[model samples]
Target chain A: MLGYIDKIREIGERLFTDGKVDVVIGFAKGSMPMMNEPMMARSSGDLQKMVWDGNCGINLANYLTNRKEKIGIVAKGCDSRNIVTHIIENKIKRDQLYIIGVPCKGMIDRRAISKAVPGEVTEVIETRDSIRVKGRDFDETFDRGDVLQKNCAVCLHRNPVIYDELVADPVVEQTGIDRYEDVRKIDSLSTEEKWRFFDDLLSPCVRCYACRNACPLCYCPTCFVDESKPQWVGKGIDDIDIKTFHFLRAYHCAGRCTDCGSCERSCPVGINMRVLTKKLEMDCKDLFDWEAGLTLDKRPPLDTYRPDDPNNFIK
Target chain B: MDFMGIERDRLHLSWISSAEATKFIDVVGEVTAAIKALGPNTNFVKNKAKAA
Candidate 1:
């Protein structure tokens, strides 16, 4: 974890000093326990505040969309992939970026840790292999690998597919992960059971739009929910409206989302929003044999077509 | 659902797991050839997209 911080600081300082970029987006130690706030450093002096750890789960690529200035970003595998997606979708130019890549083992699950703790956690300390969480009354230690975020646990693309330079040697990517086990479990349910599954799954939503805002892929002049002309979804906390919002948001990210897990991480209420996106990811993998953001030159599955693409799902 | 039937080509699906490592290369090769045959996707683009 300290190695990541050192590498990030070194790269950040050089990029800021060399005038390679106007901003270097990285993570800073958050005031709150188990949170790493995203920081935008404009000068080399500001790199002092930058830190890298498991809490650096928010995708820095989220800050890159629609920006005109050149950017230097500390990119994990998923973040770098989203950068590739941004380039392909014309949201940002590849030349405008200086990507310092980190091969990730997967971020620690803060929610899992909170659940594991007997009391409210006041502070937390992490290493490459273990995390120690301290509460007002108690402290507990656990192996880091045991509590990784669900998406991170199943990540196959752990190495940055694109990078300007490396922070460390790329880690071995996880394979045979059976990423869609949960998706398949839900798929086996009856139609009504599936409806109830999502209805119950989305019940705690407060309509904060944090999920949409956190996704690097969701850049539009006006989001569909805010459109007043036709008003596709109601503004109030209507259940149907909430369902509509989630459905359309996930649909919009089809073939584009790198599954960075930012949307899920940003939600105040712990909704497993990846369930929606992962279904599309699985379908894309099954039918088109494609994954998003793996290469700079190839277009996304939806943006391109095949003459003899899979017709099994079609009528 | 939007891209069903011959329209299904517009919504391509692929399922090459990493466990089948050698099969992945061959699968990607085939998909590439087919998509190249179909060329760039203009079927779903709108006039608004062109202006943007």
Candidate 2:
């Protein structure tokens, strides 16, 4: 992890000193444990402050939308995928930025570790295989893979699909994993059970919209939630209102979401929102044989339909 | 979804997992009747008509 941090700073310095990019987007040491903040660097002086580790979970590609400056941004597999989606969507021209790709090892789930700790987790130490968590009176160790974010555990792309340079040798992507096993479990449920399952899942939502704001795909000028003339979803905290908001939020991201886990990471209450997106991703893959952000030339599943599209679901 | 504009009843593609096979048939029967009661799709068209 430390070696990667040095490599990232070295690349950031070169990009800044050579005047190849006006701003560099990456991570900096956070003020608290299991946290790293997205940072923007303009000079080698600012580049010196960059850091990288499992805590660099926030996707930096979320900052690329509508920016005109030449950007040198660090991207993990998911971030790079989001970047591909962005270029395809015309949010940022491909030639306008340099991607510093990081071959990712799955990011650790901070909430999982925090929940496991007996006391406040004040310090987190990471090695290649294990994480040693420490606080005032307790110290515990966990296998790195066991504590990975659910999305990372099932991630198909660990290496950036596109990049100008890589900070390290590409990590092997996961294979033979049933990424939709949970979705299948839910799909096996009756309609009423399925509705109850989601209702229970989303009941704890506080309507913070943190998940919406954290998503790279949600760049709508006036998000449906904010529309006044015919407000698509109400502002109150009613149960159906929350469900409607979440339903549309996931629907809007039908074919474009990269399974980046940023939406779930940003939720204040840890809603496990990936269930909704994963269901759509499964549908896209099974019904259309499509994966988002894998290629620039191909259109997303929902963007185009074939005459032979499956019609088995209709009665 | 574009087919909804012409005839909303044109598509209903569902694959029942073997585990849900026994129950999904009943659900499909209910869904078919619900679609019949809903009538033709005019959601976006009505909005455009109102604007015109």
Candidate 3:
């Protein structure tokens, strides 16, 4: 924990002193325990406010797309993958970014914690050893392993695969395990059942566009849904409109979504947006042996075409 | 109506997932036949009578 703090401070100071970066985008301690709000540090004095712990789940690389300034940011395993995708897409130049990579053991899902403790969770105490949750009723202690994200359970890489400076020692080599068991269960349903599931899941969407806003990959200047003149999608939560929004987003993110789990995290009604992206990822791999955000030099499968490309659907 | 020369009501296409294989193919086949029956792209008439 100290190692990461020191590394972050050191890099922040260096960047500020050298004028390499104008602002440092990282995590800061939130008012609540085990919560990290995305901090934008401008000067060396603001660097003192930075904090990294078990709860820094929000990917900061998502902010890099529209900004034109020289910025330094903390990148975790999944975060770095999104950065890599940005580099590949030419959204942000690598030289403009000071990627301070941090190793992650997945972030805690606060909803899961609240479920376990109910109304007792008054405050949280996060440290290197364990997170102590204090409630009005009684205080409860949860091992870091218990409340962490499901992705972290079978995570192969606890360390960032790419970084400008290493903040901590390499933990272990991550094993390549498919993280789609839930998706598979959902996929096994009959066509009508699947349609019903999707319809029911999206029934609560108010067309607020929060999912699109929170998504890092959804950086299009004018989203198809937002175009008024052509109006690709209507404003109402009709069956066709809702389905179009999901399908369009999934297609746009094909061979691009890093599975950072932000879309689902940011959804207000808890839509399982990961299902669409994961299915697309699996299809891309199966059809083209292509994985998203792994390489900067390689073109995404959709952008390139081969004469011998497999067309299984063709009669 | 006239939307940048290519009509709005006649700009017909449906987006479906591969998981909806049977329905997807069925819908596409039906939509394509309907569009063919509607004739060329310029023949798009605004169905304003049914407008909400």
Q: Proportion of native contacts in model 3?
A: 0.00
Candidate that would win on TM-score: 2
Error of 3 at A82 (Å): 0.8
Winner of 1 and 2 under TM-score: 2
lDDT of 2 at A151: 93
Q: Give me the TM-scores for chain A across all models, comma-separated.
A: 0.97, 0.97, 0.92
Off by over 4 Å in 2: A311-315, B1-52
RMSD values, in order shown = 11.5, 8.4, 8.1
Which candidate achieves the best lDDT against the true structure? Answer: 2
For model 2, the docking class works out as: incorrect
TM-score of 1: 0.85
Q: Write the per-residue lDDT of candidate 2 for residues A1-315, one digit (tens) a residue.
A: 557978888998888779899999999989998888899998889988888889888877899999999999999999999999999999999999899999998999999999998889999999888999999999999999999998999999989999999999998878999999998888777544666677789889999999999999999999999999898777866666787788778889988989999999989999998888888888889999988998888988777878888765554
Arrange candidates by TM-score, descending.
Answer: 2, 1, 3
Error of 3 at A20 (Å): 1.6
Worst 10 residues of 1 chain A by lDDT: A306-315
**With candidate 3 superimposed using the best TM-score fit, by how many Å does residue A157's alpha carbon deviate from the native?**
4.5
Error of 2 at A29 (Å): 1.6
Ranking by lDDT: 2, 1, 3
